[model samples]
Target: MSKNIIITGTSRGIGFELVQLFAKADYNVLALSRNSKPIEALELKNVIALSFDLSKKDDYKKVESFIGSNWKQVDVLIHNAGTLLNKPFVETSMEDFEHVYKTNVFGVTELTRIAIPFMQRTSHVVTISSMGGVQGSMKFPGLAAYSSSKGAVITLTELLAEEYKETGPSFNVLALGAVQTEMLEEAFPGYQAPTTALEMAQYIFDFSLNGNKYYNGKILQVSSSTP
Candidate 1:
């Protein structure tokens, strides 16, 4: 049987590309996003579009429900939903910070928490991170909220990786660099992005399907220069 996969933020960009690529590979894809509109170009037999707001605390329960009602085991879980708030810390309001954390950190963590029960030993969990998560760039003065949330995401991935050394499933984070997506456009309008969404999605699909034991707990960075 084909592997079952769940991917969040499938409305557009990298997440959207991931949904298309996985479905094309015959994987049972549960594409989750706030918008439920189907991608006409990506119509596939094994793909299901689920509408849910990741920022809402109750959405995790919906995820669990969908899993229970559909599949017994989720072969892969991809936490790819994220947002970018490009503003200085002082100018960023409390609401903006909370919203960013709610979607990137809290929502992702809670979804993973609920997903663990359905994951098998051979299952894989992939979280999409950013280069900003690994390094602090003062040159990009207005991204504190977004960058800090991603940093927390990477730390969470590491903590989970170490904690699940025995019976836990494989966990990995992909630190995608400068992906050419709507998110990047929103972050830096009129600036050219180096990476394409479709290419990055294909790379991520290949990485997840490699079935290598050594890949577990690895932080794989995908960039224009990465070979």
Candidate 2:
């Protein structure tokens, strides 16, 4: 059987582009997203697209069950599913914070927890974060919840890498700069980004293929500027 990869948020943007890249490379991509239409439209023989909202515990639990039963080994697991809340800290409510964290942090944690048992000895776990999570960066007014959750992602990735050092899988996070995606448009509105989703996808694809060999327990700052 071909090598397997599990990636979240494959409906569009980086996740969709990643499925294309990996599928072209002959890797069996277990693509999970909230919508099945886009995945089905890909028509790639190697891609297995499952539709489920990552933020919903019940929906993600189904994913855990499917993977546990069907997958013997996962080579790479990319946590790319995330939500953006572009509201001021004062306006951000507890429910808003929980909503953002549910998908960006909690869902990722739970999915990784379930996937750990099936990961290969050299497996790599990559989480896509944001430059907004970086400290000392220009504080954008409307990203309190979003930025904090990504900060949690960075911390979570570090801890997991150290905790699993003796086990097998290597954990790392990419603190992405502005990338041209729907999410970017939603957050930054009218601002132009230096990188495109496809460009970022290529970088992530190459890293996912070989990053674990050289880097582990690190936060890779992937941005064009200090943004």
Candidate 3:
């Protein structure tokens, strides 16, 4: 039987490309996003599309119920969906921070919580973090909120790995550098990134498939020196 994988933020960017990679490899790809059109357009039989606002607590039941009813085992769960609020700390409002955290942190937490029941013993749960979240990295002035949110997930993933060690599943986080995506463009307008969305997607795909063999409760940094 083919493995089953769940990926969030699948409407575009790294998430979208991941859907393609997994689906092409014959994995049952359950793709979730707030909007469904982009994924639906792929028209792949192995791909299942789900729609819900990740930031909202109420929307989670749709995902939980769907997976609960249909799949007994999930081989992988990738938390690739996130948001950014690029503004100076002084100007960043509480709403902006909350908005970013809702999806970047809380959403990932809740989704992973609900997904654990269905995960197989060897399942890999992965979170896509940011380079800005890494300590000793050069800090940007306008990314206080976004970086903090990513940093929170990095820590959370580590804690989860330790807590779940007795269990069979593995948990890991990837602290990524700048990628060529709309999110990156939006966060740093006109800045060129060496890594493309598809490139990052490929890396994530390989990691999800086999990373657990070598890593668990670790944060791997992926980036070029130039950023």
Candidate 4:
């Protein structure tokens, strides 16, 4: 049977490429993004694209309903959608932090909560984080809100893995470096990244399928160069 996969942030960059990779591999993909036009335009086979906003509580129900009505099971769930704010800490407002956390942290939590019941021991949950989230690593200015939100998800993944260890649905997070995506450009303008969106998505696509075999609740640093 073809596996059912849910991937967020599918409007562009890594998430966009990921949707294609899974679809071409014969997996049933549910691509969610705030803007569904990009994925819908592709018209790929075995794929369903929805305009989903992570920060909105109601958006999760749409995902649950889709699964319940069509898939009835989730083989993989990848939290790839994230919001980034490029502003100095002193200049960033409380709303800025909340906005970032809303989507990156709380959003991940709610979706996983809704999807867990549909997943089995063999299921995998892959979260796409950033190297900026890694402690003791190089820190950059003007990213207090964005980077911290990414960091929060790292811990969230760890806790979920431990809690679910006895039951199933292995969890792991990838702390990626500067990938040449729109998000990267927004964070650091004009700075070219060594890896492309497709390249990174390819790695994530493979890992999401097999990494659970040997690892769980671990943070893998996937970066070739610093930002």
Candidate 5:
């Protein structure tokens, strides 16, 4: 049987491109995003686009039901839904930090817990992080909330990998560099990234499929640019 994959943040950017790559490869893909219209519009074969909000507990039920009904086993779970906060440290509020963590950190944990039951030892969990989240990486002034949340998930991924080492599913995190996506454009206007979303997504597609063979609980720095 073809591998069953679940990818979040699929409305656009890397997640959007990843879904198409998997679909073209004849893999079964479940694309999750708050705005599923773009993927639904495409009507790609071997793919199901669902409206999913990572922060909403109710939305997770949609995922559980789908997996329970159709795909009893999941091969890959990619956490790509993240929110960005461009405000300065001084301007950032508690609510701001909570909101970012909701999707980036908490949502990842919750979804992984839910997916574990359906994943075998061969399944792979790929979490998308940011270059800014890596310790000693170049620090940006206005991304305290966003960067910090990304950092949290890195540790979370590590802990999960260790805890499940003796289990079936393997977990890993990728600290990525700037990719020219709408999120980056919104956060930093006109700052052209050396990489495009599709390019990065292709790299992730390959990694998710085979990275588990070599590494688990590893943080791979996938960056060519600093900012």
Candidate 6:
């Protein structure tokens, strides 16, 4: 049977690339994003476009509805929808921090929670995090709120992995470094990004299907130089 994968933020960038790759690999894909319009260029069978805001609480219900109307089990869930805020720590407002956390941390957490029961045993949950989650890299400045939010996501990934250690699905986070996406453009205007979305998507797809149990609960870093 073909694996069923659900990818968020599929309107563009890494998420869009992932949808294409997985669909090409003969996997059933449910692509979710605010822009639910179908991409005529990606005319692949076994692919469905879903519209929902990951930052909102009601979006989980929309996901549930989609799943209920389609597949029975989810083989993989990729949390790729995230927001980045760049400003001095002193200038960062509480609202900005809350907004970032809601999407990066709380939203992801809720989606994973709702997806657990629908996921099959040994299913994989891949969260697209960043090196910012680990440490504030020098390339970008005044991103404390975004970095801190991703840090929470990393912690959540570890805890979820441990919680499901006995019988639940596997959880992992990808700490991507400088991927060339809209988020990067928004974070650092005019700066050249080191990684491409297609490359990162391919790596993520390979990692998810490799069935390497050891990767669970670990943060895998993806850079152009390091495979």
Q: Highest lDDT: which candidate?
A: 4
lDDT (CA) per prediction: 0.82, 0.89, 0.91, 0.95, 0.94, 0.83
lDDT tens readout by residue for model 1, 11-123: 99888998888877789988888886854346778888878788876777778998999997898888888988998779999999999999999988888888899988888
Q: Per-prediction TM-score, please? A: 0.93, 0.96, 0.97, 0.99, 0.98, 0.92
TM-score preference between candidates 1 and 4, better one: 4
**Residue 17 displacement in candidate 6 (angstroms):** 0.6
lDDT of 1 at 206: 77
Task: Quote the positional error of residue 100 for candidate 3 in Å.
Answer: 0.7
Tell me the deviation in Å of residue 114 in model 3: 0.2
lDDT of 5 by residue, 3-34 (tens): 99999999999999999999999999999999
Error of 1 at 30 (Å): 0.6
All candidates in order of lDDT, best leading: 4, 5, 3, 2, 6, 1
lDDT of 6 by residue, 141-209 (tens): 688888888788888889988999888689999888887888888887876777789988999998777
Q: How accurate is candidate 6 locally (lDDT)?
A: 0.83
Worst 10 residues of 3 by lDDT: 218-227
Candidate 1: where is the Cα deviation over 4 Å?
40-42, 136-139, 225-227
Q: List CA RMSD, all candidates.
A: 2.3, 1.2, 1.0, 0.6, 0.7, 2.3
What order do candidates take by TM-score, descending?
A: 4, 5, 3, 2, 1, 6
Model 4 earns a TM-score of 0.99
**Candidate 5 segments exceeding 4 Å error:** none
lDDT of candidate 3 over 1-227, digit per residue (tens): 89999999999999999999999999998899998899999899889998878888888888888887888788999999988888878899999999999999999999999899888769999999998998887678899999999999999988999989988589999999989998998888999989889999999999998999999999999988534
Which regions of candidate 3 are displaced past 4 Å? none
Model 3 residue 61 lDDT?
A: 88
Better model by lDDT, 5 or 6?
A: 5
